[model samples]
Target chain A: MSDAAATLKSLPQSGGFNNSPLAQWVKANLFPNWWSTVITLVLTYFILKFLFGALSWSLFNAVWSIEGTDTEVCRELKGIGACWALIAEKHRFILFGTYPFQEHWRPALLIVVFLVLYGLSTVRALWNYWLGVVWAAGLLSIGILMWGGVFGLRFVEQERWGGLPITLMLATFGIALAFPLGILLALGRRSDMPAIKAICVAYIELIRGVPLISLLFMASVMLPLFLPEGLTIDKLLRAQIAIILFAAAYLAEVVRGGLQAIPKGQYEAADALGLSYWKKTGFIVLPQALKIVIPPLVNTFIGLFKDTSLVLIIGIYDLLNAAKTSTIEPKWQGFSIEAYVFVSIIYFVFCFAMSKYSQKIEAELSHTHKH
Target chain B: MASIPRSRPAPPSIKLSLSDPVVRAIVFQVLVVGGVALLVWYLVSNTMANMEARKIASGFGFLNREAGFAISEHSIDYSPADSYFRALVVGVLNTLIVAILGIILATILGTIIGIGRLAKNWLISQICSVYIEVMRNLPLALQLVFWYYAVILENLPSAREAHNPLPGVFVSSRGIMVPVPANDPTYGWMLIACLIGIVGTVLLSRWAKARQAATGQQFPMLRAAAGLILGLPLLAWLAGGAPTVLDWPELRGFNFQGGGTLTPEFAALLIGLVTYTAAFVAEIVRSGILAVSHGQTEASSALGLKRGLTLRLVILPQALRVIIPPMISQYLNITKNSSLAVLIGYPDLVSIANTTLNQTGQAIEGIGIIMMVYLTVSLSIAAFGNWYNKRIALTER
Candidate 1:
């Protein structure tokens, strides 16, 4: 009987996974908690129902490749599946709106170039300080390919450039130019001179307060008024400048957060070493501040990437605009869902990657700083 | 050393003139000032010349002229005959409406999603993660257009096939319709009571908080405050119940009459701004909650504080300080984004300004007012944010 008691006491608690009693209880009583179990069961039922319904509509019953009118086919498949014919016929317009049909490959190539450039930038081994070269080269190649005035390709006007390439260019060029401008503005705001600081503050505040739409409106309509006669600026250039200015304002604030976080002693130390203002800033202050702000900086970049779609408001045919224009065609009018879904997927992929990249960088930085 | 400065006084005299530090500082200040002044002067001269040659007059005088255009959404009584200045004010007010609404909705949704993201349930967190990731990455403009076209516009029944669910409510491809309040004189008093209730509740909440701090006892402040605010208004309404009447919408043929209708354009713009801003707010809230160290919560729990009470008293105050600044920027973003109303032809400030500029050939004046209005609104928001931030900021000894 003593041995039996000892054996009973020595036996391990079944299904014990966690040290905490609550965790252990949850593990042991998986579906034993009445309210939670009911909720789980209900949720599971609904989720499975939704999954099956979606599968039936989108996969099993969906028209995969029917070469006929969507109206007739979709009516037959009503309450059964998605009519995907709209996307099949109108995808070209959605991807490369109003571009010459024969020259669609140019924009297609531009997309590949952009992806490759971005892919290269993501890898730590390839992300050299001088990787600006790759971006510059990529931008040039994209511009030439899309605009096509140089090196045996037909000249395409800025007006004709549309779709994803425009969106990518706007974001890429905006960041490429705005980052340096933002750093300078941030430095100026933190400068000893009151005048420079005040000016920087005014500029940043003014640009940041207004929506990107207003700025685009101003760029498209009012920019010509501010320039000299016959020195006409391209609409694309005007939009680009506006985006750069607007992005710099927001980026400056992010960078300033980094600047504020750096210890004052570092500045004093650099000063104590008799380094000049530019020397100290270039070597000490900026590098540290930039490093500290990478996550937020990348956040801003991702934001700008998404925000580039606003140029469509000013009649610049960007990716969103292209998708919109595609949907309005008589044949594709009802296929709005397919077009939007396709574009949303593209945006999701790019955005998700960028966000993950930002997270990874943040984790690496935090880990290194801890040691 | 004894041989080297023999001419200098053993007890050195204090020299105030032209020290290296002073000289250097003076030179730097002068260079900076002079350079800025020069740049400003150049831009000014260039701008003046350009404006003069273009025959564009610059000033606030045109503001008093008749606007001659109707705005789609106006909070104030306005007409096409109203002054341009008043029209701009209408636009500004409209912008504020969108911003405020977006901020409130985003905050509630974002908080819920943020907490949901950290929930113990696997399904809840996974759903939240997908929502955040998907929404955060898509361009807000595209989303807005998609919502407008694919969801709202396409799904709605056509005008002839209108869905009238109630006597005073109508739904169709055009938009939703609901009864408007009868223009009653008692509304003025209702407005006054609302103001009083707001102020009284604020004061009472403060007093209650002070009382709680002075004593270890807790007050049911939220319930009490809610009663005071709502009950007072209800009492006022009952006392003057005979003063107002309902204005029910009536369906005339295929159209809804005698009720306010929400145009698809306005609905789309509002929806876009809210959803887009909500995504950012979700991330901000999640980060804010995560930022509060785990130890703080553990400590609160260790003291035998209830979960609700601990969240109300301890975690929230700290999280709020982190949350408000970003939330303010999101508000600004929403305000600015409402200008996208122009795309679908909602007569927002930018659209109105664009129309005015196009019509009167007063591009400079029209654009200037737009810029100034935006600048003012933006500055005010920033100022308010800074003030609120300072108020809730943690004090360190």
Candidate 2:
């Protein structure tokens, strides 16, 4: 027993917690030095002041209900808070734009469906051939709902379809269609034939050299001129095609980066096996190259999503346009801040989720590569 | 094995021309080229027919016609009487102004934020991360609109309630009016002095480098260069009467008069572009800095170098190699995105061309001009980037 006691005395002593966890954390992280302490204090004070001011403006003094012309209430509150009642009064118009009032449910449901499809896609277990089928079916259902000509539902022109549904459809279709075209273009760029290579290079560079706004303008203006008389296409379709072509060029470059990363040994091995060219590319090469490029591919998708908002310039009533239009209501003329904030939150949520998903996929891919 | 092979090797049969891979490839190429040519021909013919039917005379001739539109912000003197070509020039200049200013501001802000992300202070780093995430995730167009309508116009006090926040500055919904120097003839001499100072600084820096190599002595090259550039210009200005006349804006009627104005549209476009692009630049910078292995810092420290010295001598040179290429692309992106200025009525090239096209029914020509301008800008930036990249690339002998 005496020997044991002596051994215990020789062990390192723990500095038994003299301070609380919060105090210790604060000392270590924020107040390690005089300058750090000052900086921390000053920054914290300003951040809190700003936060509380925003909170009070957005919450405490904000008018919540659409009762009466609540413009008076907002004027009285002045700079103290937001006028949320403006959003309340204009939410439907902001969400659906010129879509028929009673049929607002169609777009509202389409948004939920799109969200479900997005969620489904995020699940690793659902990543199979069936996923493609699901996407196709989902897109078809969304189309039928938006352009109702069957089941006794009223027929709505594409022109009448606006707001969030249009934004979702354009982005989804743009990325989906661009993917295959991008792969083809990437392949063409890497081909041995000079003619094919030149054409691909020219297309990619020309599209990438200009802004999406210019392309949209070309679609809206020049496309009609190029088409024969009586072969008119919908304006929305024209913009959608422009988006597809523009995205394909960017995506082609990204895919080319992945293809270049692949080892020449893989191609040589497949050739040695006497695999046909298409078989080799489709079965042996593409799977690995595409897997390697998933992160960048998702990044391109995020860019495409943000870019879809530019359709507003071409007079498309996308989500941002709808929100902007809502603010023009005489009753809510100056309350654009609230509407913009709401729309920004929606964009932020989608973009942040996509970025996070890409990061996660990148981490997983690298982890798998380690084995 | 050779004897066995000699037993029965019938003269190699010539492959059928139809089955030959070379022939197949040629056919495929011909088919693709022919298809593309056919499509182009079809488009041209259809366009011609459409133009004939619409009675729209198509050509570049419209460029010489008068552009009867007033541009709000122009770097050059522009009037409704100006030809469309001159109007387009003003538009291009306006685009360049925004791009140049945006590049400068974004670089400054992004570098600061990027360094802050790696700061020893946890709160500072977190704040910087949040700022980057929030700024990057939102659509730039939305941000531009919000900045124009909500942040600047709605929030600022109207002209009737204008306030002088600074000695010679006025803030109102009309715009932020600030004092500017009157155009003086002696300014040209000051500019010449500045050019001379720049040349002198370059020569001095090269001399300093040579002296350091020859004699192992350190010179304060940066301080000396700054003195030459700034002091020479100051002395020249002083010699030329100091040109101290200020054009301070005064509240006249419902507007401010007599000073340069930063219109709300310009302010909004600049802020939106800078903040959005800065987020991307911050990530590039952070990644570039991180890419320089941590061992570099430790090695410099082991050699007894101070922190700032280590960063300057060991870290930045390596980080810049990684930073520059992406930074070039960001610059190109900024130039291209400046087209979005039209959303807020900033009369950029696209906006001006759009108006011209609407007036002249020259959609094809208008779009073609816009494309050519953008392509030229893009190609120039890319060419410059490639040259710079080659100069800085690692020389692996």
Candidate 3:
């Protein structure tokens, strides 16, 4: 420490900034020797200037209240910011799509249930078998909320269930169900049995080769042809199946990568102990392999979450579709930006949080592995 | 322990039981085969019943029938009067063109950005990082919409207010206009010369490198190749002197004329697919570079090689083996995601197939064709990628 101090003391600096060594050095070397400091300041100044202007125009100088004639109200706040009145008039359609106006609370309730599930899952203490019960109960409650007929409730058709909650439900259920299917497929692919391995590989590669939109289209349009004459499937159920199948294929690959990374010695050790195949896998291999795969698995989940928006192509009014529908309303025809921005922020929040959580899990797993 | 072994040795042949390995294997095989057969039989029966009831024919022969819808863009000759088969071909070609061009552009852009993220320059690195973060976080479909509706449609100058560069080039919301070459014998010869020059330059590079290594003499390979590839082509064109005239887009009332127009949907889909895939590619490249050990760099430096030389000679060769596999997937991803063009009406293969299915009520046939096309494309890419990977892999053992 003294040697470093002596070295620092021996170094000369320009006599400026009250003769503080660091400040004098910065002023002389950073400011004078490099143009980067000057360029950075200039760029920062312009960026901040633009940001402030946009903020002022979008918020401070904006029309807040829905009052007067449309043009007149906007004119009244001429120097003010954005006309948020369009959103006020059309926010319901954006939130609930073509669901009955009075029944908007049903979808709203469903959204709350979803939020609770998401919140609970984020807490480590709550991530247990009881939480599984909570999730199952919550899902049932949401279903009842959306489609009422039990316990003196009104019956709502699947067609009427639209907007953000439906999107989240499809993605969440798809991922949950796909997780087990993916694990089975991954194990089957790695199975010593040739028939099982071939079947698993074919299923995974066939599904992964095609785009989700095509699969969704097949599910929506052509699935009925493959069903028995008397059997009929709901459109939403078919879309859910497509989502599950697609997610499972991608997730299976991620899981397979993890399984391959587990050393052969683990399997040999399990065999040496005379454990049955199922016991060996269930008690030992899967836990360690899954820990290795948390990052990629989360990524696959995020991909599926974002991909739920493709349901809109088959006329399922998901969040983006709902937003589009809202923007097309005569009262809010030109405010598509605000509606899109709102939906994008919702998606960004979910996806960003998932990735950040995945990173955290990865760090923890690596830390544990090292010791 | 010895007594138990003697009991097994007493048997003339290996015994099989329900719990034994052979019986278990046979039972499992029979069960799997039976299950698959059952599924196939069920599906076939159901499909026949549905087709009989709906009176919808289920053969690919319908492809020969006329497809009456006009396509927005085509690289080859096509018309509304053409057969569904022809229309499908046009769609497939369009998909390939976009996928190939997008892959090339994405690779170039991704490598640059990936390296820039690791550069000593702080600004460049930060800018690249920010780009990756924002793009990777956003849903590609949303980015497509933003590019289409907000950036391209809102910001592009109208035809009346078109931005022009030089005499013949014009830019508008409609499309970019540049001089298109007309048919001429002399120009054809010049193109042939250019092709020859390209091949010659490649051969000359190999020869130059070999000579430099053998004789301890440096070769000006870049300059020589540049002269052969560019100068020869230019000289051939100059000798022939077949002047090509510019055919500028003229404003005919409201719309521009005399040049090809890129539809907004196509532009949006192309940009989105390339940018989204490029982000993944950039991450792959960054990881690939990191996978090359610092010891490799130190070793090169100790051998008195410059930084650039070390990177090109030692690092990139190692990094590429890591990079290529994931990069191939990213390419495949870009190709597959181009199917999103259906949402915005870009008329890709899936869009054309949808139209075909809707018009003919041939759901099974249309879907089968679509799946087959995608399967073929995927398998070909997988095969090529594997072969390329094998070539680049280090023989460490």
Q: Which numbered prediction scores highest in DockQ against the true structure?
A: 2
- Model 1, A182-234: lDDT tens digits are 99899888876666788799888778877787788878877786665668889
Q: Please rank every candidate by TM-score, starting with the best.
A: 2, 3, 1
lDDT of each residue in A1-371, candidate 2, tens digit only? 85676566446555655355775677678876668878998999999998999999999888887566658878677678798887788788777889999899999999998999999999988999999998998998898899999987799988888888888889999999999999999999998777888999999999999999999999999999999999998889999999999999999999998899999999888877978779999998888899999999999999999999999999999999999998786867788899999889989999999999999999999999999
Task: For candidate 3, write residues A1-371 as lDDT tens digits.
Answer: 85676567557766755477776555544343235566556656876887798898678777666764454665455434566676676678777877888878888888888888888887777766899999899988988888899888788888888888778889999999999999999998998778888999999999988888889989988899999898999988899999999999999999999999999899888977978778999988998898799889988988898898888888888888887677564555545566677777888888888888898888988899899
DockQ for each numbered candidate: 0.41, 0.52, 0.41
- Residue A71's lDDT in candidate 3: 44
Count: clashes, candidate 2? 1
Model 1 docking grade: acceptable
- Write candidate 1's Cα lDDT for B1-397 as tens digits: 1122344455466454543444455566678778878876765676678778978777777788998888867889999999988888887787677667777887788888888787666666667888788888888888778777876677677766778788767788778788888887667676777778889889988888899889967788788778777777667777777465677766677766777878787778777777777767888888899999999999999999999989998999999999999888887777777777777676778888888777677776777778888788778888999999999999889
lDDT of 3 by residue, B1-397 (tens): 1122344545577777675555676688679878988998999899899999989987788888889999988888899999999999988988887788789988988888898778554555677887787777777777776677645664567778878876767777776666566555677777888899899998988888899889978888779888987888788878878467545567898777775556677777888888887878888999999999999999999999999999899999999999999888887888888888887778789999999999999988888888889888988998899999999898887
Q: Candidate 2, which segments miss by more than 4 Å at Cα? A: A1-24, B1-19, B203-220
Cα lDDT of model 3 overall? 0.81
Q: How much is the lDDT of residue A55 in candidate 2?
A: 94
Q: So what's the TM-score on candidate 2?
A: 0.94
Provide the lDDT at B274 for model 1. Answer: 74
Model 1 has how many clashing residue pairs? 0
